[model samples]
Target: MHGPLNPESPVAAKVFPSPNHGERKEGRRPDMVILHYTGMASESEALQWLCNPVSQVSAHYFVFEDGRVLQLVPEARRAWHAGRSWWNGEDDTNSASIGIEIANAGHPGGLPPFPDAQIESVIALTKDIATRWRVPAERVLAHSDVAPGRKVDPGEKFPWEVLHEAGVGHWVKPASIQDGRFFSRGDRGMPVEALQAMFAMYGYGIKISGVFDEDTEKVVAAFQRHFRPERIDGVADASTIITLRDLIAKRPAPTAS
Candidate 1:
């Protein structure tokens, strides 16, 4: 953290460096993008808190409501975001992903809608970073996606489809909400195991225990929050299953010879 400010992204006009960051573990280069919402009452307050040393947290970029973008950490450093998070068996999400904190009052503030100006900026920034990093669409993840049961910022209210429309992240039409033979907290058997396997395959931290438990429900809710925002009640309903399967199907194939 030395000389003049350097913007890791072309979209960022300036840098407001946060001290609460470290070198990426073993020089790990980013291959993922993690999106978050400020979740506080005011954008200014959220930005200040992120830069505060006591907060021990910062993202690589912050997208303000008026479409202003600020780079708080260099892409080569491990920003102190993504604390205690896990994804696809990797625990150091901060070191593996470019984190973007979007300005919006999240669940703590009743999940206010993100302004279009801010979302557009996010889309622009994400597309640029994703392209340069060769990040797969499916690797652009929500905060909830990496830390189920521990974090839920950038909640269901966030317009993921809008970002997808702008070619930023992976998205699909949510399975229609309907009544069907669904699994719940009390169910168990081959179906439950199958559900857990599918979720785990999709990078969710779930166990194929053949028993529908609270952890399974939380992971299901996290999956819904990121994939199927139409409903997020932690129930493994048919809609959730179909959505998960569809997402898996749409995932890109490996380029093997």
Candidate 2:
């Protein structure tokens, strides 16, 4: 099939179309932006895999370490990223979001730091997409955020505070870690239920079952990966709870009809 002649965002230098995409479901327009890491040994191989039909995985855009941007799947189409994910009760994440895959060695390769140029390009690309789509800042998220335990791309090493500085995503100064009350797997009660409810209200796919289950731990870790990267032990410590509460407080109010 012929690829698009032009890139969707001006930041994208060219169109290197991927075959692994399809029509967005139910005429849904993208309202979220999901960031990811290629997590492959090389950028070329990663791009090739995304464009390969057999891989069945692709994102709307790809960013290289040197800050080069390429468009793989059109924004109007649903790229095969965000599989089996959920956010704010929306299970069809691929249908409601644009995915940007950044080339990096990732966790397997020792969690290398993202280059300044690369992060700049990401900020520019994200800003353009968010502005054009009118996506809320809170809706910009990490792949790990939607899939927890199952996916952790664009890992904690990724500089979210930098993106926030560029006015891309929502962020707040993480509450300092200190010895205090905490919740972890095996713990159960009203506090656990309230913690789960807070996570759910913040759009994380967590169950308010009053038990600190494995799933709850994963969700907490995922939240830390995005918001409070100083520590991500999956334990809902004082810092984590405070940061989550601050984020909830800072969330934008719904627009009136």
Candidate 3:
């Protein structure tokens, strides 16, 4: 927490230390990588806010619009980015994952396309972190994946397929959107329970209740935002269900520790 900052990944050009980090709980080593968008008007403002102690939020690394990467918090430390998040049975996501904030004028700024250079840098940085830390492809997740109703960053515009092609994250071609038996808010039955079970099986933090409630809607939307992004209205259409099933079926096996 002192002295000259040392960049943990070679992808990072320099260190821009932020005071908004703490020790990882129980000395947990990062086994996941969480991607996010700054959702600000400018990259400078986003970077400044992250480094400012008052913001109380930070990521281990920050990527600029033109593809420049900066180390903010040491990889060994816990950055305060994943607030009130849960993933794959872990509530302390900050302690178990490395956070990367991409500088994009996210949803608020019309969900601008990420430059090819910037996305290439993201792929390189993610590959480095996943390789060095032994992070799994499925564990490389969007911010929306962890905090369902609360957060949505590195939004639908993010080229998850590109990252998968670059061997950074898990992905499967989304099933074609179509009409059929779908679940939505207010629906309830054994089918709903089955749907909930499938989502929970895939690491979404949702109760296995037999009713399609608000929380279920939110989780469905979150799943779509990450997987079947073509339509994200919180409705579980055949396309969404098929896509989720395919992802689960094709998920990479856990690597031996």
Candidate 4:
């Protein structure tokens, strides 16, 4: 593909075209926003990798640590992000989501804090993309949300609440952490089934089986990473359960038919 000199979002300072993209599958329009961290020590290296066709990955936009935004692929095209992921019963996430890669050292670099400037840029870019696409607030998600266990970018340290406050994503004040009844792997019963159902209802790709299996643990961890960052032990403590319940209750209503 030829380089795109003009950016799809005004928030983007310029375009840094990447060849790793294709037409949105089945002509599906983007309805979700997926955020990721480049997870490399050097921001330049991360940017280059996204643009490298050999890497087989790319995002619609990339945000630098200094708050500069670059459009890597056009919003109308499907970038090679969110691979092998699922959400709200949709397996082809890339076809229906716009992806943003925020440059950060991520978990490998001890999960460093996102700079204030960088976060501001992320908020501005996300608002632009979501607004233009009419994407729902609840659909703004971390990479882990769609591909739990397989990927965890823009990790727990990412400030989801800040984005929510800026009207960019769904969020709720996490329930306080405390000792109480909790669920963990190896536990199995109707309660486990209920927990799985709640997660599925919230768009998590979890099966409603009565077993708290490894997949359940991973999904719970992903939920914690996005919602309750204070702790992400994979165990469903009272705090996690309550937080999940609150999120579901606050989810935006479906559009009228």
Pick the lDDT winner.
2
lDDT of 1 by residue, 79-153 (tens): 887888888889899999999999888898888888888888898999999888888889999999999988897
Model 4: per-residue Cα lDDT over 51-124, one tens digit each: 99899999999999999999999888999999999999899999999999999999899999999999999999
Q: Residue pairs in steric clash, candidate 3?
A: none
lDDT of 3 by residue, 147-235 (tens): 99899988999999999998989999999987778899999999999999999999999999999999999999999999989989999
TM-score of model 2 (CA atoms): 0.98
Residue ranges of candidate 4 with Cα displaced over 4 Å: 1-4
> lDDT of all predictions, in order shown?
0.89, 0.94, 0.94, 0.94
Error of 3 at 24 (Å): 0.8
Off by over 4 Å in 1: 255-257
Root-mean-square deviation per candidate: 1.5, 1.2, 0.8, 1.2
Candidate 3 lands at a TM-score of 0.98
Report the error of model 2 at residue 244, Å.
0.1
Clashes of 4: 0
Query: Residue 23, candidate 1: how far off, in angstroms?
Result: 1.5
lDDT, residue 202, candidate 1:
86
Looking at model 2, the pairs that clash are none
Residue pairs in clash, model 4: none
